[model samples]
Structure formats: structure tokens, C-alpha cells
Target chain A: MTNRSFEQVSALLDDAIADTREQAQQLDTLLSDNEAQQVWARYALYGRVLKGEAAAQAPADISAMVAARIRQEAPPSQVVQGRFGKHRMARWLRPAGSVAIAASVALVAVLTVQQSQPVAPEQSVEPAFATNPLGGRSPVSYNTVLQQNAPSEAERAQQLRLLQSYMLDHSQQLQLSLQAQQLNEQSEAAAPQKDDN
Target chain B: MNNLKQQHHKKMITNAWRSSITGLLLLCGFLSSSAISQPFQVTDSNQNQAVALYDEMARALRELNFEATLVRSSGTRLEPMTWLHGVYPDGTEVELIVMLNGPDMRILRIGDDTSYYEPHDEAYTIHSDVTFGLLPAAFYKNFSELQPHYQVVGGRGVRVSGRNTHFLRILSRDNDRYHYGLWIDVESKMLLKMQMMTPQGDILEQLQVTTFVERENVPIGMSDVRGIPRPPRLYEVRNLRPPQFNLQPQWLPAGFELLRAGHRRVADSGLPVDYYLFSDGLTEVSIYVGSQQQQGLPSLAMQGRESIVNSTQQNLAVTAVGKVPVTTLQRMVDSMRAVEPNATQP
Candidate 1:
């Protein structure tokens, strides 16, 4: 590509990377909110299914499911539609789409399974999802797995915060590397012409 | 095996003898040259004549009016240029126009005021010392003072620029500054060819008389050059406070002494800078002291024409610029200290 065209492409890529990072952060915040917990749970479930993990069985607590769904997806769907369906989907799908799809599938499967299962107390299912995956892990157990599991409300919040920071840092570094590569290519292309002189 | 051992022993003995002889010859050669060049008593009348001739040549330089084409050399680079008219006694209205051929088109003139005219920019003014080339003021002041330092001797005659020229060697007493050799015109006493030699006897600069005209030529005024504008008067004479040194240097190189000191405004800080000048008859050093800045101390060892500037910053930023070694300049800076207000003398 010509130098000017290359620069233009580089700038567009930079903008795309920045936009992706901003959307990821917003999704993380939306997932953490108590009102949007069920939608967030669906997204997390979808993320697990995409990574080939089994979907969580939905709780028999219909009242909680309906309340959580209304708080999470209803507002977002209205806003997304009010803006533009295709454009909103495109923005959300490009970066977080894999995790998002997995989270959705898991939540749908859980809800469908709940329709068939016997009713359980609201607190029992909440503890299963909210507590550390290895809550009953012994002291002799490897610390790596324990560290990885985002147990409790505080730990999950901290995990999301750390993830956002790591993603932002990585995205910034990638953008800088891409910019340097583009500059090097331009300089290399110009060098031959200068040598000919 | 015994035969090989004997052969090796013979070779070793031969090598040792050869090296010893070589070393002895080198020592003898050095001593012989040193003896030949030594300053001996001037008993012969011709030796006195050589000194007298040099004295006359120095005086003649201040009186004669002639046109010359000179070539100045520094290291591997050579700058050829021409100059026209005037001398010191005549209130010399000299015009030196140097055409810098290599790298860029630079035209320099030293007359009523030093000016540089380049094709890319308008003519700009310069200071006197920079414009007068590298000839020391001591040469114009007195020729006899240089006799003890430089051993002047006559050399073989040669014809240059279609005029008979007599050569003279101005050998140094020490290796501090470079040596000079000159070819003077037999009749007019005009300098034809001048050469500056390195300490190791390598020619650093050579200015030859490519063409010479000793005629009653009318002097050219500064206005004679068209398109070249007159340089504006930039220096404003200000009443400045004399520099006060809190500490004095215990030791300085021979012939060097403090000349002048004053406080002047520096460019970067726009603050009063304590400035001092020291000269060893020929070479001059300027020392400036001011308040410290946010930036780190500037590095030492920047080169000029036979000069080096060393700067160091502590509580104060001290800069010493002169034709001296970096170590010498550093020592000068280290010697500086703060003095009491009452002790300062204007």
C-alpha cells in the first residue's frame, strides 16, 4: 500500500482496537450489576459453553429469573433497538461475542432445565453460582486453581476489574506495536528510493 | 633433536642482538636531533641577522599593502580564499573575501565590521576575533617576546607566485602550540606561503601564494560590494558589575593570567552571569558561572580551533572555554568558590 493509504488503515485499526476495549469494559460493568445479574449470568454461562464447559441447570425460581431478565436484557434491547439493531450487534459481537454467546447458551439451557426439574429454594442455587467453584477445597490443594476461581461477590468484582485492566493494557501495547510496524514499513519503502538517488 | 635445539639457541641469540642494536640506534638518533635543534648561544653575525630579519618582517606586516590568495588547512580539510588591500600602519582598510567551496556557499568578509554572507540567508555580523582568522594579537604587539619561545631560522629560497621568496622556520620551544613556517617575498617582505605544523611535524594548514600583486591599489570601502548589506551594530555597551571570585586558583599554567571579569546577563536563564577571562598571551579562556538549572550538567570536552570547553554543574553551573585540555578546564572550574560581599572589588 502507498504510505498515505497505509497510515489511513493504521489509524482505522487503532480506532477499532480502542472501541473494542471500551465496549469490553462496559460489558464487564453491566455483567457486575445486581439488577442485571441474570443477563450477566446468561453471558457467563454462554462464555463457559463456548469454551466447551457444560451449561448450568436453570433454577426453579421463576420469580427471580423473570426479575433478573427484565433488569438485564430488557433495557439494553430497547436502547440497542432505539439506536440500530445491526450496528449495536456488530459492535457487541466483534470482541466479546465468543464469551457472550457461551454465556447466553448456558443461561438458556439452565432455564430450560429448570422448567423440567423440581422447585428448589432461591438461596441454594445462588450459593452454588456465587461461592468459589472449589469452596470445599482442602489446604493441601494447589493454590493455582483457588486463585483462578472468582469466589464470593468481592472476588468476582475484583476478577472483572483485573480482567478489564489486563485487556486495556494488552490492547494499548498491541496498538503501539502495530503503529511501529507501519512506520517501519513506510521507512523501508522510502529507503530504497533514497538509495537509488 | 640436539641439532634442532642448537639451531633455536642460535636464532634466539641473533634476535636479541638485533633488537639491542635497534634500540641503541633509536636513542642516539633522538639525542642527536635534540642537540641540533637546541637553543645555542648566538655568536655568529648571520644568526643575529636572522632575528633582525624576523623583526623587520613583523614590522613590515603592519605596513605593507598587497593582495594575496591564501589556503587555510585544518586536519584533512583545506579552505582556499583571497584577500585584498591595506595594513595596520595605514589604518588598514583590508577586504578579506573567502569563498567556502566545499559543503556550502559561504562568503566571509572582515573589514570595518566582520560579516558573513550566505546564499541562503542575509548577511550577518560577526565578532573581531572570529573574523581576523587565527593570528594572535601578540604577533602585532611585539615580535621580540616570541623569540625566547620560538627559534627562528633561515631556510632554502624558493620562487612563489613569480616572486623570489625566502623561507623561515619558527620552531617551538615546547609542544604546547603548533609550529609555523613562512615564505616571505625578498623585496616587498610580503608573506607568500605560511604553514602550521602539528606537534608531530604534520602539516595541519598550508596557505600558499597562488597569486600576488604588490601595486598601489586603491582601498575598497565596505559599500563597494553590491547586494551585501551593511551589518547592523548589535553590541550595546553596558555598565556591568565586575566579577568577584570567592576562591582563587593556586596554580595556573605558565604565562596565563586573569585578564578581566564582569557580571553579564546570560541567554538561557536571563539571570546575571559571573564571567571571567584568562589568557596565556595567545590563547584565551572564558569562564561563566550561574545558578543551576533543571537539566543535568552538560558534558565536558567540546572542541574548537585548538581549544576545548569543559562545563560542570554543582550548586552553580560552571563553564570554562579555552584552548586547553579538558582536565585543565575542570581544574579551573573546581577552583571557583563563593566570596563575601564586602571582599569583592570592582
Candidate 2:
């Protein structure tokens, strides 16, 4: 029989062709032929799988050696999605990460350069009070009184440092004397207790 | 087996330490409560009332074991802090000032050394009786010393901190300096509020006590801070010759006497500065003289209650700093003159 006859037989078995006397005769003929019966059995198995009626069994007809070899290799189904997705993402991020790091480094370089520039007199003297115990009240410089918004001469900065140091020393001295007085009183108070003992 | 034995020993030691700390805290709490139950005497006398009030307040500050939450305002900035003062059984004075907002700025005074602890700075110690940064130094001094510089007059009685208070106006003897107004608790003679004002009545700075708690036992932080080592001394006046200034002040305000006259190395710089310290008992003014060509002092600066006036005479640069009006400091500058080669200057 021609392959066209086999195709008619397959369609009749699936109930896709019109049921008639002619299709019934074709189905009977295909059932008698062993080769056509094998083809019909294969189509029935594929249909069972599509309907999810059976477990997805490996081809038992294949040799054991061939099945084992296939299992040893990477699974073909997941290889493309898993490996290639991560690879593509990493390729895109490389240049972006480099740019971010470079931008931060450039920002730090700019800040360092700005610090070396001469500061305005007000900006320089006013901020020193933040860290000073006297806060913003302490005097700066010994000769030239710096007015608001005036330009600070580089040499005057040294004089300011000296004046601040002097003020700190003076406060320290006051604290020391106070401490000494307290200590003396403490010893004096202890003297009577010692005598009683 | 040896390791297991060592672990058990460590656990026992830890348990003992915990129990001891708990016992100490309970004892302190009990003692403090008992002390607070005692009635504090407050004198409201008609004879020498202002002088007696001042004396009583000074004594309360030095002798009382108390804690106060105060608001200290300078210009537009206001700082809220808790001040604790206690006397140990051994007679050592312990005080703590804890800032309530922002960074933890703490100053702990145990006997002689006052140590400052701040978040950004290294903890350092200063030798002081009372922490200078919290209250005016003059408040701790004897009332007799303050008489010449200030006129302590009694003002109308008012209520402060929920207590009946008497106002003591510490008016400057001269018009050139700032004045202070104090509200003393009538019952305890404890200072409830103090304001430093300009000659024109502009408030420069103020300290108001919101809560005053008197406890008999030492405060909590005071006992804990006793173990912390004091920082090294920052200033040492070694064997160095005193400086001779070419210019000297010709006049000083009434009753203000020269305390000391000497020269010290201007800060860390090797440059010499002539320093003259003058006081009228309560108020102190420091005059620093540096070479005009070497150092540049600001012409005039005023922050809160303190004013600094700077002037140049001949080759000398003179700067005066105190809680005084600009005119008073300016008068000091105007009074400077060059001394003769053979003549001694005071």
C-alpha cells in the first residue's frame, strides 16, 4: 500500500476522519498489517502522555548504554535558561560597576583639592568653636581682629591657633586650682577620722 | 574535664559580681530616699537679707547632695542638662553634668579632677572644683570677693520652680559691665534661676532649674566614675622668666585689683605674650599682649555674656576678655601707654 493509505488509516484510528464505510475498511486493513499496527501503538502512547494519563517513561526500547550516556551529560532542558541568564546579567553589570567605583574615587579627589584652598576668615574661625569647649565664644587671633566675611590671611591662621591654645591653658589652670582645693578639704576631713581610729 | 571545671568557676565568679553590683545599687537607692525625707531649712531674714541669701546659696551649692535638671540658654541656643552633686562618705566631692540632647556630653568631677566625655573627642581631665562649663565660676567664689565688683541688692520676691523665691540683683558696680539677676529658693536658698544681662537689660545668657532633687547618698554616675583614670595635665608653667611689656594699662575700673602679671609662651607658639589677670572678686578680666607685627587679634567679639576687645598700641597688641560691656573693655584699651625705659609699670 502507498504511504497515503497509511495516513488515512492513522486518521481513522484517531477518529479525525469521517466515519463511513470507506474509513472502516481502511482501519480494518491497517490492523492486519504489522508495521501499520506498530505506528498506531506509537501514536496512542504519545496521546496518553499529552493527556497526562501516564508517567513520562524513558524509552525502554533504547539500549541501556545509550540511556546511561544521556543521563551523564548536562540536562538539555535547563541548560539554556539557568547558565545563559546569569552569564548575560554579569556581562551587562561589569562596565556599570566600574563606572560607579570610578565616580566615587573622582568625588573624593575633588574634595581633597578643595580643602587645600584658602578658607574665608569667618568660615575658618567660626567652625573652630564647634570642637572647642568654650563653643563659639572664644577669641581668635591676637593682633588683627577678623571682621565677618573678611578674607583670612594664611599667616593669621597660626596666630589664631596660638590664641586658642592660650585660652585652653587658662581654663585648665582654673580647673586645676579648684581641684587642689577639693583635695585639701578631703584630706582635712579624713584627718579627724584617722585620729578617732 | 578540666575545661568544664574552668567554665563552672567562671560562671560562679560572674554570679558573685552581679550580686555585688545589685546590692550596691539597692543600698544607694535606700540611703538617698532616707536623706530626701529630711526637711531642709531655708532662712528668709530681713537683716542683711541679700548677703545672707548669697551666703546660703553658695553653701548649698558646695555642701548639698542634690540633682537638678536645668535649662541653660546662650543667645538663641538652649541646652538642657542634668546636674548632680554629691559628697561621698569620705568627704570627696563628686559632681556630674549630663547633656540631655544631641551627643552625650558628660563632665564628671571626682574630688579635684574634672573629666569630660564626649562622643567625638578624647576624654580629658581638668583640675577644677566645680565644672566651669556648667555654672559661672563666680558663683562658687566667696561672696565677700564679689562685693567690690557687684552691688547685691534684694529685689521683689517671686515664685520659681514651684518654690517661693527671692530675687538678688547683682548689678555691676560700673555701667560698662553686664549684670546678673538670681532667684533663690526661700526655703533652701538654692539658686533656682540666674540671668546675665547687658547694661541695657538685654539677656545675654540664662540658667533656670526645672527640677531640684536632694539625695543623701552619692549619685549613681559618681560612684561609677571614681575608677576612671584622670587624663594627663595639659598645662605646666615651668621655670621660665616672666615677660616685660612695653605698654601698661594706666587705669582700671573701681575696686578691680591686679591679680597677677607674668609672661607665658603664647600657647604652643614660642612667641611670648604678656598676661595680666585682674579681678574685682566676682568678675575676672584677662589682658593678653602680643607683638602686633607677629599676631593679629580680632578687633572686637561678643558671644553670649562674654566680650573681647582688641587694640594695638605702639608695637603691642592688647586684647581684653571678660563678661563685661564693650565700653569697659574699650576703656581698658584706651588706658594703655608706653612705659619709660627706666620706670617700672604695674
Candidate 3:
């Protein structure tokens, strides 16, 4: 209806409006008019020429190239905030989802493989052997050279003292184990249903 | 006439097929229902029987006078030992444990005084009602003491030491600690074999009896041990008090309670350490929180049923050791958080 329609269509193409949805709809309505469409096409060509994007010699298949590009693109009217936002979200999530799945698969594979393999043998401490304490000599000789032996003799003695404490600590655990058994039984009786059942 | 006969035969075959299918479906329904009901009936009785058997085993160990030869195996090493238990006419209990391999080590307990005699170490005595042996600790303790942490379950009967034996497996409720399986002689109620397994079902240690003989008189060797001299003074554990630690564990397996807490000096480093002991009845773990001087020790190591997880937090080193699965120990150490002085509940 007014020359302002051509200027508004141009502004919509350049994304110059803050409210893009209203401007896009206005441009769609204007394009329906043949006269407005012709003016829009002429303005686009003129802008491209001014920007030096137009070819010096027109390409022979330029029309075919433009048609193919238009076919590849989504319809401008359909690509609004909601649909395009979802498309962008899906693109962003694809790699993150793939990485998470890959990590879980690797973890499962590793656990299954570990379960199938035989357990490795534990390292053996020095076996308690017969020694004459009355001889006034350190009779308990270790077969494996312990790391503590690397330090001075005082360190080795300290290590033995530490071993003594460890043994004492372990011996005390026997009492706790007995207590645990009783507690477990009481809990089991109070709740007749067990986990395995 | 032939056509009519063929039709009758076809009708009979179809009826037979339909009835058979219906019967099959009925059978499946009945089977599924019974299977669903079986656990309640079976497990209830099994629980009662297992509890009774555990009580019987404890009574057998206390009242019965028997001498048994046992072999304890851990990793590649094997240690054979002889266990002796007797009750005198004056109502005194005497038990002796003799190590038959590599060591001239022996344990002698008369009433409440249990003494340990090992090579190159002074014979020290500790006041205890039960003597330590290769069998599980569950055998010597009362059911009340152990019922809170481990579930006692009856397992299939098996032959052990050439005797008919019934199994009572002590399963940890949380599945984070070690599990123990014991085979008791059906007739005598004596423990025939004991096996300690990791959470993943790997055998870490086993003690199996080779010979069990009831003695009418006290063995001559045990009588000779009764005369050992003793002083009134004993090596006392000085840290008999509660813990003074800022760090408290935030996570623990089910039924695990704090048994002992104190501060003890490290014999190797002379660094003071806050110690806490936790137990789920059948398994125990010790946690030590000290200065960062202990960081040079192994971060993680597992041997037999015992594992160690050493970690540091906020310039403090936390080490946990016990006969538990590695993951269990790791969780205990990782859950430790430094608490504000007023917020500390333990």
C-alpha cells in the first residue's frame, strides 16, 4: 500500500528490527505482492553489487545454484525461535550424549573383564620361625629385604615395633568380629526378610 | 463312511492338543506360585536352625575337651597348628595353642589369663575368656555379640575332614566387608573348617582340621606349660580413652559401630595419631588420622583379607586398615571430614 513496504522488507532481510517475528511476517505479506517482490529482488541485486559480491561476468548456472541453495535451507517462515532453538539444542547434545554412553560402556566392559580374571596372589610376609631368644642375638631373620631395612638399624628396630603394634591391633579385631556376628543375627531376626531372599 | 471316520479322528486330535496346552499352562502357574512362596517357608526355618547351631558350636568349644590339628593357609604359605582345650575337675578351663610349623610360638590360657609365647619376643599375657585360634572368632563369641553386623545363614551340608558337616555362612549385610563360611561337625558341633572370603568371593584364608581327638586327661605338654612364671606388671595399652580427633567418618557400612577410640604414638615416626576402631561384628577396620608425616607409606595395599587405604586431607594423613574389601576401606577413608569442634558428635 505504501513505499514503506519495500524499506521494511529490506530491513527484515538485514535483521535490523528488534522484534524480528513481526518484521518477518510483514515481509512475508509484502512478498505476496508481485510489485513488492520485483522491488525486493532488484534491491538485493543492487546491494550485492555495491558490496562487490556480484560476479563481474554473470555465472551461466547462477540461477540453478541459487535454487539448489534454497532447496537445502529450511523455509524462513518455519525456522522461528521455538523450532530453531530445538534444532540447536539437539546439535549441542549429540556429542555430550555420545561421550556419556561411551564412558558407561567402557566401565561395564572393564568390570566384567576384571571379574573373569583369576585373583592375583597376595604378597607374603615373613613366616614366624623358631628362634632361640636366650642366645642374646636377633634371631628373627627376614627372608625378604623389607624397605625399612634400607634405613639405619634404629629404623629397622622401629619397624619391628610397628609390626608388633599392627599384630596387636589385628588380634583385637577378633573380638569385634564376634560382636558383629551377634548384631547381624539380631537385625536379621527383627527383619525376617533378608536381602538375598 | 471313511470320510466321517476321518473327521471324527481329526476332532479328537484337536481336543487332545487343546487339553494338553491348557494343562501345561496350569502347571506353569502353579510352579511360579510355589516358587514365590518357597523362600518364606525355607528361610524362616533356616534362620532358626542356623542360630541354634551357632549356639551349639559355642557350647562345644567351652564344655568339650578336644585336641585338634589344624592347617592355616594364606596366599602361598601354610602353617600347621595343634589346638587343645580342657576343663579340670576343679572347674578351671585350660587351653593351649601350639604352632607346628616354622615358629616355636605357643598360646597358653588358664582361666582369664591368656599368654602368648613367640620366638625373640617376651611372653606377655592379656586377660581374655577365649584363646585365639585359626578358626573364625564367631566360634568363641556369643550370638548376641555378633548378631548386629553379620547375618548367620544355613548353607548346604558338605563333607569336611572326612566328617558330615553343616555350613553356617556369616554374610555381611552391606556387601562391603568380608564374608566368612564355617563347616561344623554335625555330631560334635566342632568347627571342621573356616574360610574367609572377600566381597568378590575370592578365598583369602582358610583353616581346615586334619584330626580331632577327645582327651580324657589333660595332655602332658599342656601341663608342662602351666608352670610358666609371670610378673604382676604387664605391658599396658595406655590409650584406653576416647578419641580426640577433628575428623569423623561420614559413611560406614550397615551395623558398624565404633568399638575403640584413642590417640597412640607411631612407633616408627613418633608422630601422635588419633585411632578409631569400627566393627560390623565379623569384620573390623582401624582408622588413623595423624599429621602428614605418614604420607610416604603405601597409598593402597591389599594382603590376604587385610587392606590398607592411606589418604591425606587438609595436611592430615588418614590411614585405614582391616580385614575388609579394598573398596570398603577406601569408602571409609574418603568419607572422613574435618568437623568443627562444636559440631563433633563422636
Candidate 4:
């Protein structure tokens, strides 16, 4: 049998498709040919892999060639509907191993969230009163706690710096307000007598 | 095995050092709290005498020739400065404040003009009666004018800064403002210590004169300031344009009056903000409105007795800060209503 007949038989086994009468006639030609029967035996071994049986003697290059053929033709698999059903390895994992992977991923996400519960100091600030002795600052410093959580360190620092600048500017700078007050009251009050000589 | 022993010894030393530091900090905290526990009495006092003493201090602070070496203590910060006041031979009043710790924060008030000489910043002068130092401007103004909003009570005698002082307390008549405690020298009437406190006896800020020199002449510092030539006041902000936007505050404490309404840029950061300054003679509160939301202070944030309240409406951030109650600040922020640009306030 020719290489074309071997390819035809291989496609027929991988897809489990002899849907058209023309394909049936072609498979009939492959079954009567010699080389096509060897291709058929290799596919039978691949089929045993789906049946929970060992196929240790199967050639490694056969699996590679099948992957190459799938990439080149982009075949619409008749036996497979969803993405997982396309590959022989994934075909065995479909309804059970996929569930196990999903469960592990969800477990990891929940644990990550739990480990980060107390990380956001700004959002977690409670209504704090000035109860600190010495009448010092009341907000608890989160610096030591935040060392382990590296992502938000720079952002929290920026917020605190901005807040400080706001307080300092308002409390310290009075040039503008003084100007307004000065012009409002011009004579005989606070300081400058405007040297009206 | 020897290396492991060295590491263990180092760990033990570090642990001891940390515990000692913690113990010292706790002890300091206990001492300061105990200092405040003996409340300054706010009882029946001769209101007329209290007013007379306060009026005398305000006048002495402006007209006296003396040098006051003091430190303003608030929270964990200490700012030491020398305040010198004197009269020149040509009838010019000169007052100079030299910041002792920082780099070149000198303020000189020659009569009504105040000049600030700050390092790394342009030295500018403005026409004003007093420098906007941490010192309350009311200390140089007429305090009796604010008597309607406060009840002045004379407390027991106390010694401050090596001088016999008459202790006095000023309580807000209706809890509309912060209370004040004063210790004025009996001889010169100069204030030796002034405490701004919450109504609940929590001291927010304290300014204490550590050393005071009653000068026979113009204070040496003020005389030096007179010889230090000043550039002509050519850059003073004059012809002030009225505020463009109307951030009309609907509610204010009784006796509070709008002194100034205009636009201003925040110092250092140079962020543009429109503001209004209100004063009830003794204390001042300022309300700022700006579009930059990041500069808004957190809700009910207190720095010493200054309460800052920030609120947002239609993307505009409103900030009100003063040495008043946080509830009053929040209420002021709540009462603020933003109107159209240049619209007349109703």
C-alpha cells in the first residue's frame, strides 16, 4: 500500500469516522492494502490507551506524528466536541482529572486570600480616638506588619506622604489669607502702617 | 559550635536592648499622662479680672521689648525659637522670631510688614500684623473682643519659666471652640505657658517659654534685625481679586466671620485651592475647596488641636481645618455647598 493509503487509514482511526460513503469506500481500500493495516494496528494501541490499559511498546514517534498532523490539518474531530476531547491524553482526563485540577486551584485562591486578610491598613482603619498617652499620634503604625507584604508598601507610603503635605501646608502657610485680611483692614490695626508719608 | 554561641550572645543583647527601649517609652507615656491628670480648674472666676489680665497680655506681647526663648511642644515634636520684640528710635516696632533648630526659618515683623526668610525658598514679604508662626495671632490682638464667645476663668497660681505666673483658663461659652490655659508672668504680664486643650482636659498643644529676658533696651535680636538691610517690598500681593468660586459654608460657629475669601496655592506642593478664612477674634478656621481629590485629608484627622475634615461632592474636595472640635469641623464640611463659578452667594 502507498503512503496516501496509510494516512487515510490513520485519519479514519483517530477520528473514529467513516461518516461519508466515500470515506467508507476509501477505508475499504485501506483494509485490503498491506501498509494501511500496520497503521491500523498502531491506532489500535492508541485506542487501548483510552481504555485504561498499558501500551508501553507503542513507538514514541507515533504520538509526535499524530500531534504534527493535528496541527497541520486543524481537523474538526468527529469524536470530540469540547477542547479536552481532542487529545488522546486529555481524552482520558475529561470528566474526572479536570475536576481534581479545578478543586486544587480554588483551594489555592482561598488560602491566598486568607493570608492577606489584614494587609490593607487604610481600608481596615477603625474609628480611632486620641487615647494615646502623651497625647501623641493615634494611628497604629503598620510598617513592621507590612514588611512581609511587599506589594502595597510604596502605595501606602505615598498616601501617608500626601496626607502629611496637606496638613503641613494648611497649618503653616498663611500668606494668602493674611493678604486678604490685610487688604480688608487697612488702618491702625495689626502691624504695617503703609508708610503713607 | 563556637560560631553558634556568638550568634546566641548577639541575639540576647539585641533582645535586651529592645526591651529596655520599650520600657523607657512606656515610662515617658505614664509621666506625661500623669501630668495631665491634675486638671486645670475651670470654676467661678472674676470674669472682669480675667479679661483685664488677658487684655494686658495681648498688649504686652505686641508692645513690650523683650526676648522669649520658647519651645512649642505638640505630639512628639518640639520647635524651639526666640521671639524678640522691640521699638526702634524712629518709632518703628520690630519683632523677629529666629527658629533655633531648622535651617533659616526667620520671621521679622517690622510694624505691619512680615518678612519670611526660609532656606531654599524665595524670601518674600507680605503686609501683615504678625507672622504666621505656630504662635496664636490672637496673642497680639485684642482678646476682650472675643469675650462674648468665651468665659475666662482665673486658675490657681503657678510658677513657669522661673517667674510667678497667674494661671487662667478660657473656656468656650457653648463648646463651639477649643479651650485655652494661660500662665502669665505677674510682673511683666508676658505669657509664660499657653495650653490649647480639648474640652475633656486633653492637652493638644503647649507653648512654654523656657527662658525670658525682660530687656531694658530694644531686644538685641530686634536691634540686629534693624541693621540687617531689607529689600524694598515690591512683590507684596495687592489688588487681590475676589474669590471666583462660591464654596459657601451654610453653617458656622456663632461669632465666626469671614475674613478673607480668595484663591491660594498650597505651599511647597503648589496645588491650587480656593479658600475662605473665618475668625471669631481669638481663633481662626480655614475652609479650602479644590478639585484634586488626593490632597483631601482623611475624615476627622486631628493634628494637635487642629481638626481636619474632608468631604467630597461632585468630584470637588472640601477641607476645613482649625483648632476646633472634630464634630464642628465635620459639621462645617457638611454644611458646605458648591455653587457656580462667580455666582453670588445667597
Model 3 interface CAPRI class: incorrect
Of candidates 3 and 2, the better by lDDT: 2
Scored by DockQ, the top model is: 2
Question: What TM-score does candidate 1 get on C-alpha atoms?
Answer: 0.44
Report the Cα lDDT for residue B160, model 1. Answer: 79
Tell me the DockQ of each model, to 2 decimals.
0.00, 0.06, 0.01, 0.04
Model 2 residue runs over 4 Å out of place are: A1-173, A176-197, B1-47, B118-122, B233-235, B268-271, B301-304, B340-346
Better of 3 and 4 by TM-score: 4
* Chain B: TM-scores of all predictions: 0.63, 0.78, 0.81, 0.77
Q: Provide the interface RMSD of candidate 1 in angstroms, 1 decimal place.
A: 37.4
Tell me the TM-score of each prediction against the true structure. Answer: 0.44, 0.57, 0.57, 0.59
Q: Is candidate 3 or candidate 4 better by lDDT?
A: 4
lDDT of candidate 4 over B1-346, digit per residue (tens): 9999999999999999999999998787566544533444332235556778888998888777876678887655577776767777776788776666645456677887776654433344567777675566777776667768877877566889768998879888766577889999999999999898876667767899877777677754344454344423423245556655577788888889987677766444555677687888777788877764546433333334455556664456677767776656655666777566555421
Best candidate according to TM-score: 4
How do the residues B1-346 of candidate 2 rate in per-residue lDDT, one tens digit apiece? 9999999999999999999999998787566545532222122232256777788888878778776778887645667877778899888888877676666566767876666654433345556676766666678766776765676767665788778988888777566567789999887788999998876677877899987766667754354556554543323344545657756787787877776567765433445678776767566677877777666554543323555556776657787766666556656766788666753333
**Alpha-carbon lDDT, every model:** 0.46, 0.60, 0.59, 0.61
User: How far off is residue A51 in model 4, in Å?
Assistant: 99
